[model samples]
Target chain A: MLQTEQEFIRILRSRLEGTLPEEELNDIVSDYAEHFRIGKADGRSEEELFCSLGSPDDVAREIRATHLVKKAEDVKSCKNIFHAMLATLGLGLFNLVFVLIPFILLVVLLLVVFLFGIVFAIAGPAAFIYSVLQILGIPAFAIWQSPVAGVFFSIGITTFGLLLVIGDYYLARFFYRIGIRYLKWNISVITGTEDEA
Target chain B: MNIQFKKGVLEICVLSVLARKDCYGYELVGEISKRIDISEGTIYPLLHRLKDVGYVTTYLQESAGGPSRKYYRLTEAGRKEEHEQKEEWMRFAASVNALLEGKNDAAD
Candidate 1:
């Protein structure tokens, strides 16, 4: 294959066409076109310029990862964030430990907290109902030494559960925001290479 | 001299250079690669990312005997980012250097 200006731009365009928006595609293409044009004018050969530019495919991967990560940040959806993580994972195998492990752990942590919150919230209400029934002489199951104490305890439990749920939500949001920033930093720092990992 | 190490600093280098003066795409890449050996193609994507975040903006300017060239100028935010990243990097490097030169340093 000939290492020429046109060839470099072609590879870049072909790799990025479907992923990047049309306007973005044109802007990126033009940057490299200008590079080749100016380099040639400066008396550099096509091969020399191409060599210095490294692999267009690698460049496209970085661009795609950057774009997806930005999209995920803007939209704030599961699908978007998942796509962004997948794209970043392509940058290198090291991210399997760095990005993927932490992401999975966080997801699991949030889910367990949410489940516990819901269970406590529902159980608290049910316990309160039993206490009321017992007070009315309906022979309900006893969960506490006194029906009055049970009512108070159940109310406290319900409030605590609700707070846990709400706190978990805010925690998830905070982590999501920080996670997006970390992925952006990861792409910029760890993934500029000719060999795709 | 590792490639990953070079890639990490490229963003700050580009922003620091632009904070001084506007540069065309080729000119900016040339300025950076002159000092740090890196794949020049990656700079364009980095520039686009900076632009997307409103840290930088671009314009076209006519050159002698050539088509108008696209020039990148740093925004006020870009300057702030450059200053912050430069300071953070300097502090990080200093700490790492201090650790490396400590008495337990294994490699000479």
Candidate 2:
């Protein structure tokens, strides 16, 4: 209600997210027109309302914070898209290298050490318990019947699982790094940042 | 806010907000001011970007007491984007946390 209906529509379309329907824009325009009419003389321009209302960019920022994807979509195609994609992917990579990778490796190492340590330290006892359980006939599943086969299989499963997890974790990190680097390269290529070089 | 950082992340935040409800220009100013210390003028540019992408839909409504007001709402794509961005943020943040204190300090 700060300017004429037409002026309000233009401002809303330009100042707010542009995706609003035309009819809705008309309504906004009328509201502002009425508000401006009540506030001042007919000779005054809608710019006054714009100024008093505050920076349109500021409003966009607030709106964007809430509706980032919509706002991002309308941005000039070649201009911001690369950057936006770079943003998420870059940050994700940052997390992977500085945070995720080392942490995962550490966990893997600990797990391996713990599992092997148990084998060396308390494993004898654990194996004794396994045979005892078989004698007690806990279940077909529990009674491996073959001590060597069961022990080897248990070791194999634990080691294989640990290796597999560690391998997958490292692979992910490598792929993420490559992906982000590729994306950054694409952004630079499209934006012509190399010219600055 | 760092201009670079703000420019990158702010767009995501705005779209996410519109995904929830339709808001007017001034109402947006009031809401955003509550959280981050941003120049009120910057929001205008952000809105422009959203329009370009076609993620948000806007319409004007008549006010009983005042002039018509422009109200912004999210399109289908806009809603999906909000969820995606949020998911990414949470996962990224969690991954970051895992790196810091979650590391095996005892491994060495």
Candidate 3:
């Protein structure tokens, strides 16, 4: 294949076209175009300039990762963070262990806590209903203790469940904040195009 | 040099160059590639990242024979970052040099 400025810019544009905003994409493309223009003016051949610039695809991937990570930081959401993580994973295979594993672990942990909270919350209401029925002498189910005692236990379970749910929300928010910082650090340090050197 | 070592130093290299004087993308790439054997394409993305973080800003300057060029200048935060990184790199390099010389003497 011919190593010309057009091909370099084409590859970069094709990869980054949709990922980056239109103006930002144009700005980045202009930088490379200018680089080629100046290099040629300095008496360097197109092929020499292209070869020194390295793979345009790698450069595009790094740019995309940086942009996605920044977007995630600016707007915190599941979709944004997921997109950011996927982009970062494309940087290298090392992220499978470093980024992917930890990400999955955190998601699983959050899910477990959320599910447990819901189960307890529902169970507390059912228990409360059963205790009320027992108090009315309906004899729906055998009581472990007095119906009054049962009411207290049920309330305790409800409160504990509510606390778990609230705590899980705060925990998710905390991780999201820390995760954004980590992603930014990863992009700036671990995932740069220079890493491919 | 190890790839990881080179990757870690690229930021400092870019910052130090801009700390000296603002440079257009091509000129900056030439300056760095003259010393470090790395892809020239990487520097542009690095510059963008620096700009996004407000460490560097760009301005258009007219050239003698061609269209205006976009030159990257370091921000105040960028200057502080450069100074801190330079100091850290110097101390680390000094210690490593000392350790290597000590090992050479012991080997002799």
Candidate 4:
């Protein structure tokens, strides 16, 4: 394959066009353009410079990952962080084990907690209504041995469920912050090792 | 050198070099690649990340015979980071070296 400056820039631009803003994309492209320009002036062939620069696809991947991660940090959102995680995962197969597995586990864990909270919250209210009906002499809703105790228990359950939901929210947020830091560190430390190719 | 180890230290290397003096993108890549064996392309992304984190700033400076080049200089935060990372790396390296030497002596 031809390792020309044009080819390199094209690959980079294609990879990053939709992900990065135009001005920022242009800025990144210009950096490499300048590098190639300067290197050519130094009497190095385009091939040698391109080879030293390594693969353009790899470069673009790293840039994409970094930019997405930064964007995620700036705008805290599930979508942004998920995009960042996907980008980082593209860096290498190593991330499948290191990033993807943990990410899936965390998501599943959060989802389960959220679902449990929802179930308990909804069930608590329904049970409370049933207990009230039982107290009002509705035999059809007479599941409770003690109507008054059922009322208190249902209220307690509702409060506990609400607390669990709220706690889960904060837990998700805490994990989000920690996850961002870990992704940043992971990108810095784990990336670029594949450049040996 | 282990590639993973090299990748981990690349950020510190860039910071340490920029700490010495401002350098253009190509110049900075040259400075690091001159010693370390890694992709020169990765440095640009690292530089961008540093800039994003408020650790470095860039400016256009005219070169001798060509168009102006983008030069990167460490920000105040960058200098502090460089100092802290350098210290940490030194201590960590020293401990690792000591442990390796002790293990070698025991083996002998």
Candidate 5:
């Protein structure tokens, strides 16, 4: 035989996946085994059998020429994926920060506006109702003042809060969708040229 | 019909025969020689290819008169490939046949 089990195994491990046809490897092993057995009919040594079979490397070159392709594609794809991931990460973070900065600023501004609405609902309205009661000679209702205006003010504040909540929810969802698409596009880009992907 | 063109397909034929049952390298060479004229050396490369592709495996059994003989058996994969190769050749030959038969009626 031109090869031992270990030598043959080395050649097998070296094969690039999807390059060699599966049927060819089977014959190589059987032929060498037969050759080794038949050559031994005359009481030849194992070493002598190996010598006549020629170098494993010589046989390998012919097989590899048909079965092996260049490594350049894998190397190039790996590099492209790495750079794409880094670029996507950077851009995602930038977009996230961009969304967050304005959101935070809007929240702060809304908070300030709500504090004033609360003051009007509690102190400002209370004083206004009291002064109006004094001018009308007697207190109008059993409750002493109408809370109608404050009721309207609270509804406006709640609606404004709801719009902000909804806008934030949709904005976050949009960013998540974009990130998913970015990941998918990059994955396809990396795997697009592969035979077995 | 070109030797170079037949090279790849010849190995397919050799393996297809062996896949049906165990065969010796010399026996395989003889069988191929009957189908097409080729040197003994050419058969080795084909056997090497079949083993490399995992379509066959070997065992050593001693005969009564001489040394141990290496017997080659077709693995399941080899049998399957033989069937597939047969189908492929059938399709190829049939297509060519249809085309040639359409344009001429040599039998008539």
Candidate 6:
């Protein structure tokens, strides 16, 4: 309810406390403190300055999103990018369609590919073992028409599976890179204070 | 102007301002808000982002009747970015203007 500098700083500190590093958080707070100080000295009331600055909550959210995205870029990891995506999603409802849906779809797609690769990889070795057993006079293991051909087929399947797994990895990496760029652009162009005229 | 459109250009505007001369946080916000209606708080975060990317750097400068203020100066990389963005914006604006004018003539 208060539009004082202290209230603005309080909201920012509370919102950003755990997300930003201590030094960086202090630096940001000082920027605002200085802003209020200078504006007041210019004979403007604290409420006028505060209203012009918009909501501190939005400011904190933007800063947190930007920081997380930059961190993801600096340290390449699934967890980092996931956190970055989550942060960006908080920017606006636009992200629910633009960011959240694509993110979920990508994750599901990648998971399905990985699971298929693993199943094929495991099945190839099992089939190879069964074919060898059938050749060694085990009647029940006779699934393939030709044992020699089965061996070749099993090896081919294994190679294909392995390739799929490796391809999925590179695909994930590529999307991770593109996703970071998109999130950066989204933050820069999409989010703004509600006080837009 | 669209809010999203305004936000998209905020970076270029800030870079262009810093390209001209170093400014303290309040001074820079004043310069931009005078021309564009925006949440003045957002500029600080933009400044921080610029600093993070090494596009700008800051130093403390004492004022006549106040404590030291942090002044932001554009880095070499920041200057290059400003020039590129300015050129891109110019071309984009020119084409849009041409299209609008052509449409106006056809309407008449």
**lDDT of the candidates, in the order given:** 0.89, 0.52, 0.89, 0.91, 0.52, 0.92
What C-alpha lDDT, on a 0 to 100 scale, does residue B79 get in candidate 3?
99
| DockQ of every candidate structure | 0.57, 0.08, 0.58, 0.68, 0.06, 0.74
Q: Which ten residues in a row have the lowest lDDT in candidate 6 chain A?
A: A188-197
Which residue runs does candidate 2 get wrong by more than 4 Å? A1-197, B99-108
Off by over 4 Å in 3: A191-197, B98-108
* Runs off by more than 4 Å, candidate 1: A192-197, B83-108
Which candidate has the highest TM-score of all?
A: 6
lDDT of 3 by residue, A1-197 (tens): 88999999999999998889999999999999999999999999999999999898888988998899889889989999999999988887788887999999999999999888888888888899999999999987865668888898899888888889999999999998898888777766664443455
lDDT of 5 by residue, A1-197 (tens): 44453554455435422444456565455565555566566477766545444455434443443232122122334334333333333323342354345435654664565565455445545554554664566554434344455445445555555556555556544544453344433321221111210
DockQ of 2: 0.08
DockQ score for model 1:
0.57
Per-chain TM-score, chain A, candidate 5: 0.28
The candidate scoring highest on DockQ is 6
Could you arrange the candidates by DockQ from highest to lowest?
Answer: 6, 4, 3, 1, 2, 5
Best by lDDT: 6
TM value for model 3: 0.93
TM-score of chain B of each: 0.90, 0.81, 0.92, 0.92, 0.84, 0.93
lDDT of 5 by residue, B1-108 (tens): 443444546756776778666877756755776777443334565565467569888787777887666677888898889889889998888778978779555335
Worst 10 residues of 3 chain B by lDDT: B99-108
Tens digits of per-residue lDDT for model 1, A93-134: 788998999999999999999988998899899989999988
Model 2 alpha-carbon miss at residue B44, Å: 1.5
| Preferred candidate (DockQ higher): 2 or 4 | 4
**Would candidate 4 be rated incorrect, acceptable, medium or high by CAPRI criteria?**
medium
Q: Which candidate, 2 or 4, has the higher lDDT?
A: 4
For model 4, residues B1-108, the per-residue Cα lDDT tens digits are 766788889999999999999999999999999999898998899999999889999999888989999999999999999999999999989778878777555334
RMSD of each: 3.7, 16.9, 2.9, 2.4, 18.9, 2.3
Q: For residues A1-197, what per-residue lDDT tens digits would candidate 4 score against the true structure?
A: 89999999999999999999999999999999999999999999999999999999989999999889889989999999999999999988899999999999999999888888888898898999999988888885677799999999899888888888998999999999999998998888776445473
Candidate 1: the clashing residue pairs are none
